[model samples]
Target chain A: MKDFPYTESKDTRSGFGAGLHELGKTNPNVVALCADLIGSLKMDAFVKDFPERFFQVGIAEANMMGLAAGLTIGGKIPFTGTFANFSTGRVYDQIRQSIAYSGKNVKICASHAGLTLGEDGATHQILEDIGLMKMLPHMCVINPCDYNQTKAATLAIADYEGPVYLRFGRPVVPNFTPADQQFEIGKGVLLNEGADVSIFATGHLVWKAILAGKLLADKGINAEIINIHTIKPLDARMILESARKTRCVVTAEEHQMNGGLGDSIAQLLAREEPLPLEMVAVNDSFGESGTPDQLMEKYGLNETAIVAAVEKVMARKTK
Target chain B: MAQSTASETHAPEATKSVAELQQIATQVRRDIVRMVHAVNSGHPGGSLGCTELLVSLYFKVMQHTPEPFDMNGIGQDLFFLSNGHISPVFYSVLARSGYFPVSELATFRKLNSRLQGHPATHEHLPGIRIASGSLGQGLSVATGAAQAKKLNGDQSTVFVLMGDGELEEGQIWEAALYAPHHKVDNLMAFVDRNGQQIDGPTDKIGGLGDLRAKFEAFGWRVLETDGNQFETLLATIKEGQGLLGQGVPVMVLMDTQMGFGVDFMMGSHKWHGVAPNDEQLATALKQLEVEKASDY
Candidate 1:
């Protein structure tokens, strides 16, 4: 397995805050609106630096979405910050009518995605956001793995002129990706190349996939690892290429099994290159209050799950 | 597809006399009836009720270059229809004001038409800046646009219209609290206090008590006017414009009849979304007379 060592660990939300603060200096048209989660979203620096561009919308997600859509009318790139639940489900219709259907240039920046929002329980942990956002026609869904990757993605989407949904986690994860790497929207990152089972992961699960890759290598199984950052516009060519070489697949994400990255990749393989596929996702269950590691282990979203999924799929591989 | 680039022949706003506006309102009313009748599906009651307000804004009150319809509308007054069910009137006003060819009104609600049943920006409809069929969203958008105008240092006002029943939506109150709290001064929101909804009167369905008092409590400057009358409504719009940049958003409580022109359709909630039938169209058109009506 290829090494992806990290000197430090950082929460992805801080990366977003840092990127937004940097954009404040570079892009004059970049404006931000937070639904009373300024501190939670780590937007204090941007708010402090560019007081004029920051809007404290006060615990109203629907109004924040509408205002973001409207701000695009005056040529302002609006980034709305809130939890994933409120960002997608609570304001789905508002986003549908104003931002998606109208094709407004609004960035829906969601933090505390999936069960990683530990101690908050299922109410705060949103595992359905990726599905909801990807279903929108004009929306681009991104779920970066680490701090540097999330920060680079945050900077990259500002140049893209359409509605985008950038989701990141609450807990700190190993910051292994390149600090100066340029983010490509729909391109998959190949972490390790192998010939046995292909493991595709996103968000916080990328590190887990790398761990699974190492574990699989120890067991004499050469697993291919890839990071899919963009969910809506899935890197279909890369996924199909990896699947063709490996002849089996194991998809992992800190999201629901029904409509997450696994579902998108499954659909792609089902239509084009049919192969043995296993998914490591929340099996249609809500998470309870627990620590981040406890929730990840209990909900079957860890390196063990990925390694086990790899084993299960290899057993079903066409002989 | 040989269509006119409408801005070339557009007359300057504020140059049209009140008498000229009234004439255009008559034509707009005719167009609303015809467009809805052609589809056999649309909302005409509120459309007829809102003819004068839309005509007044497009013809005399708003400072806009109605041609080459750009999305930003920078340095120009922008208007959004929050009560998008009344799109028959919005489309008629937009087309007649030269945002697009008035003949395109034939495509209203038809297969692959720019004019959806509600106003949408996806079809590249020139005048519409945002989609608003789903209620209680336009005010927040207008406030945001108003903030954008402030950020760009563009001294133009952002106007939005919503139905009285739409106040039942929690988002409107959120916006109501937001606009004034942020000191968004360059925004104007008008509520169609026609006291009607799809089922029955707004008061009977879901009451919005004393909108003026509510807006005032939310720190907005309140003004009331008759929406159907050109003289009173235009004067009220001018006064609302005067209230801009005073560190408070303005709300105009517009009192209008659900159906104003046609004798059979006016003063009731039955015609809220029903189209004029063949016999009803003949009867309604006869009631609304114009010497030189430009019907699409």
Candidate 2:
């Protein structure tokens, strides 16, 4: 298998800031609103460059969500930036009524998603965002893998006409994806070609999945790795095709096992193409204060965890 | 652009005298009562309470287009119903002011009807720009619309109405704190100080003490008007509009009685969300009279 290599690591939130700053220069109608976490969200560049279009909504995420919805009424595309917890649960009703249910063009760009948020504890680390956002009918939920992919997803969603939940993380992980890649929503990225198992991963877990692929390769077990970015309109065709080829599946994401990438894939596979499956996700639980690495390892979200899940599913695969 | 929409149909009419506006308000009150009573569901108390404000805004104050309704509302005025439980009044005013067919008022809360129990834009309703059954979100939406208008160099004002009780929601204060800081002068927010909510009197349940002082302290140019009357309230709204584009938002505290027109429903929070029955509907309808326009 050809190794996916990266020389540098970067935070996905910076990618969001970079994309937003570029959008500020390109699309005049693109407006940014932050609920008082400009530095954490890495939105200072956009704020400094496009002060006129930036809205500092203080510590009120609900108002920010509602404001973003209202901004769409006058042909303005509003991008609201906040922590994943604040972005999803705190302001869910605002998002539901104004943005999602109203079909407003608002991009809810959430940073510090999942356990990778690091040290801020369970109160800040939101493990249930994917489920809450994906449940909304008109809302598109996306969780890009790395810095380049995050930036590309940010840029692509600007042209999309509806509410979108673009999830990213605070940790500086491997920036492995192409810098100039065209991000397509609901389309999975194939990182490897193998026959033994299909490794479906998303968000920060994608890099871990790639590492797991390398490990399984050394063990003479061919593994296929696919990056699922959009969790709402899932890439069913790609997932099922990969599953059919591999016969067994392993789904991974830095989210809860209850309502996440794994849950979605499990349902999809059970319905269209039933296969032996194992998931690398946090079983219904809350996160606590720890370094990103510690959290991932403790929560069984690292490469080793994926390998373990693969091994478990391999044993269940039918000959 | 607001002045040029087809005035005779599906658009707000040209400026009318105080008497003529009162007549339209009467017809609107009739529409509000009948629409709610038809479904045996919906809020008529607050709807009837704010009839004068809704009628006055559509007929006299706002420069808006009802025909070929644009969600963007660029270069034209926009109105957001923040107190959306009072949708009875909002829907009545929207239909009578030409946003939709007045006859469609019959489908107020019916399935497959644009006139949802709460104001919703997803129904493809002509005038509604956002969904707002949930309280305390309307002001934020209006503030954003006002800011959008400013960015587009469109001087048209954005109006939003909230019940006084809705102020209890923290989101309202958040928008309250943000608007004046951002210099959102193009927005005009009103509180239907009908002094009642679902449970009881607003002050008794959750005291909204000193609203004029509260808004003034928040850096808004505050105006208190009698919302039950056409002449003075319309004049107060006109004066509020003049304060726009001047670097600060405006807030108006409008005083009106809950279930204002119908005597039996008036002065009680019990009618806050309850619709009138057959006998009550006939009694309520008899209380509202207008010489100019008939009921749909």
Candidate 3:
């Protein structure tokens, strides 16, 4: 069994809360606005510490987004929080106009992404959020992997000028990334390098890819595991460099295959470096009421799936 | 909730003549008709009707610096067009006010043009503070900007114009509840109750039962005005300005006709988005009557 440390497993939302609270202390310009998701988004620390700066938009996602955009005009860095669906599709026009099109410095923090938002089912689980957000011009899309990374990303996005969408999940994954590691916007991290197959992953699936890399090593199959957290402005150079060495690639993400990390990798490979690729993702299906583990198995987004995909893609490798 | 204590500080300057401003309004209306006609794809009726209102606000009322545009819009009365399809009127007014060169009006909806089909700040249009086209969102943005101005100790007012049909969007009401509850009295919202929408009459489509009563219910001080009449519109806007920062935001319900000045297009919903052709444009131009500052 791989050692996934950090005593009590904390949800990614706590990371966002901790980061935002820290941001409130470090940066006076940081302000948080929530649409009735303060408790869910773990923004209580920021709210308590800086009451005046935190705005409770009261179950109005559209108003919250607009308020965030408006707050930016006064040089205040506004961080808006809500569920993934409401953060994207419900308030797309508000975000498109007030923030993205207007070129405002607004941090759109969305939680409860993907099948991990179990029991709430397809209604809340937004697998297409990455696609919806990445399409907007001047919008930076960041899906941080673990607790530490999420916190770092939250803090980092607060300082980065212009509009950004920081997507995190509902469940707690391995907190392996260094807690003090500075988060870079468009850079991808290579976890373990190998030559047999390159494993590209994002969000919760990054831990799964790490485990798959270990498993593949045990099976005498070298796996180069790369963490691609930033989906848009994708780490194309990192992905291509790793893929060229391995000549085969497999992408993993807790999202739909259509517009997720796999599709991003495919587009990069098809244009720059052609390579045989396999994807371990939800295959054109909506999630249902179940535990996170059950959903991962049913949706084919697991370590076993990643291992299988690596083997399959490796077989098709020519060089 | 801290109440805003700052007073309105208008620039010490000369007031413009109604006739002088009306000339600009007429040319803007001409731009609205021509741009809509050139593409065969734009909203003209609401644009024509709101020309004088926009002219009164940008030219005569609002105090803003035309050069070295600032995004925050400190020390300036900011205007947001909620129903953004009427960009020709807005673009023309912005041009005449010197937000950009008047030459850009010719590139309204053409390729690589800053003047998109809908008004967007993304193209870096100087006068536009926010991108508005998706209805009912401009008021919320304006309310937020108004609140920001208050926070920054700036006494500038934030003005927004919305279509009567756009009132159907729930976000408008959400912002309505927030503005007065938070005491965001630095904001003024105007509803262009032109009585028409793309589908048909607003009452027939969705029925905005009682606009004044609705705004009043939302804790806004409601005022009514004839949007077509320059003096009356200016007087009403001045009244709205006088009532600002007095606990509740003021909403001016500007009653207007769809395609107000254009002869063939006036008084009906049919001119909502359809373009007027060559002969129709000629008749409309004749009815508009070129003012002394007929730069078009």
Candidate 4:
């Protein structure tokens, strides 16, 4: 089991806000456009520091997306902020023809993603965004784990060109990852090495996977924990190598099991190195108004779900 | 290939001449009919209807350099075609104005052609900056670009065109509210107010009750003109340009007849999306006389 040492806690969205402010100082061409969620998105610092570059677009996501697409023509990198639901579903067509089809370099930054967006219910929680964004050609899909990692990932994407969708959540989670770690786009970070089972997780579920690994340690089980941040360009080689040594796998994320990280890992293994796998994700059901911890437990996205999934897959291992 | 050499050799000594510009408009109309006839596909009615406005903007009003194409369009007037189904007219003017080889128009809608069903930047087309075929999104893009220009302290202006039926889209209103509230004074939007749409007239399908009053109430300075008549279009464009940087965005309601020059296709909504047959193509071509440039 991996020892994740940390004391502080923070939401991943604040990491994005901090990274955006840092970007304003590093690059003069970096500009931001928010659809009336300035305070919710934590974009107040950037707006206060660089008043000229920050654009308050009111409550119009469609127009904000089109404007972001057009801003790229003038050599500006535009980061548009809004909730995941309005960021993807409400403005899918505008993003499709204007940004994706046109091949514009726009950064679509989404916050309050998945069921972790407590109290908003299913109307605002977008579990289908990863699928909708990954299906588009030339889109780079990412879901960072915690505050420091999300901030690192945001700065990294600004240097990397092309259309990118950076998804982050609302509630505060343990900031276990290293604060100064450099984020690699398509590379997965190996948190712990083991020979019994492999655990792949993303977003807020990474900490849960670590806790599950510790619980498995007490039961005479050795587990490998890995963070699969980038979703679209799946790191198949790393996943296959991990499966070859561990012989079984467990995938976790706060999204629908149909098109989330579990589905991506399943597709990779079914083609390359077939292995027994169990998934810890929301089943086919909408969410209701509940606290963050209550929703995670109800939707089958927690440390117990990860521990149970690992045990289930371990039973299927031939070795 | 045929159009470029023929037009270049016989082009007017000065591109700034209004008489020469009117002559090119005649050839543009001929090209639109021929391109739509070749594929047995395209929107001929709206293309013919918007010819005068296209000519007035590209040849007379806009200040742009022809050869050295720049993506940012800094210090140059920028134009966007929001309703991109009317590609025949847009592509013809882009080519005739020397953005690309005029022969490229022959590849419209064919396999592996740069000119797709609509304008796209993915094909590496020079003149088109953003992709559009879906309605109601272009005005917002234009508004954003105009804001960028002002932020950079550049004096260039931005123009966008849309259809009457396109007003049914919710994004247009969202943009209408933002542009005026933000004081995006460098933007001008023109509606091709030729009442016909695919289902029927806009009033019957979903009425955009009083667009002039709607834009005016939304804090836009309004201007009206006959889009089909070249003289009225020139004056109307000048009037809109004169209203720039006045703490308000401008909107011009251009009244046009669908399939204006062709006798058979005019005065109805039947020709909105249908292409011309061989007989209809020949008839439409006969109505448009070849200019001295002989671009087609």
Model 3: residue A248 alpha-carbon error in angstroms: 1.2
- List model 1 lDDT by residue over A1-319, tens digit each: 8888899999999999999999999999999999999999999999999999999999899999999998998899999999999999999999999999999999999999999999989999999999999999969999999999999999999999899999998899999999989999999999999999999999999999999888988999998999999997899999999999999999999999988999999999999999999999998998889999999999999999888898999999979
Candidate 2 vs candidate 4: the lDDT winner is 2
Q: What ranking of all candidate models by lDDT puts the best one first?
A: 1, 2, 4, 3
The list of candidate 3 runs beyond 4 A from truth reads A1-8, B1-14, B38-40
Q: What tens digits encode model 4's per-residue C-alpha lDDT throughout A189-295?
A: 99989999999998989988988889999998999999999997888889999999999999999998888999999999999888999999988888889999999
Poorly placed runs, candidate 1 (over 4 Å):
B1-11
Instruction: Tell me the TM-score of candidate 4's A chain.
Output: 0.98
For residues B1-296, write the lDDT of model 4, one tens digit per residue: 22122222333232466677678788998888888888989888888899988887777777665567777788777888999988889999988988888898898889999888788888888889888899888998888788777777767778899989899999999999888998988888999999999999899997888999999999999999999887888777777777887888999999998888888988678988888899988898888876564544
In model 3, what is chain B's TM-score? Answer: 0.94
The Cα local distance difference test for each model comes to 0.91, 0.90, 0.85, 0.88
lDDT per residue (tens digit) for residues A15-34 in model 2: 99999999999999999999
Q: How do the residues A202-286 of candidate 3 rate in per-residue lDDT, one tens digit apiece?
A: 9999988888888888999988888998998899889999998989999999888898889989999999998899999888887
Better of 2 and 3 by lDDT: 2
Question: Pairs clashing in candidate 3?
Answer: none
For model 2 the local lDDT of residue A53 reads: 94
Which stretch of 10 consecutive residues in model 2 chain B shows the poorest summed lDDT? Answer: B1-10
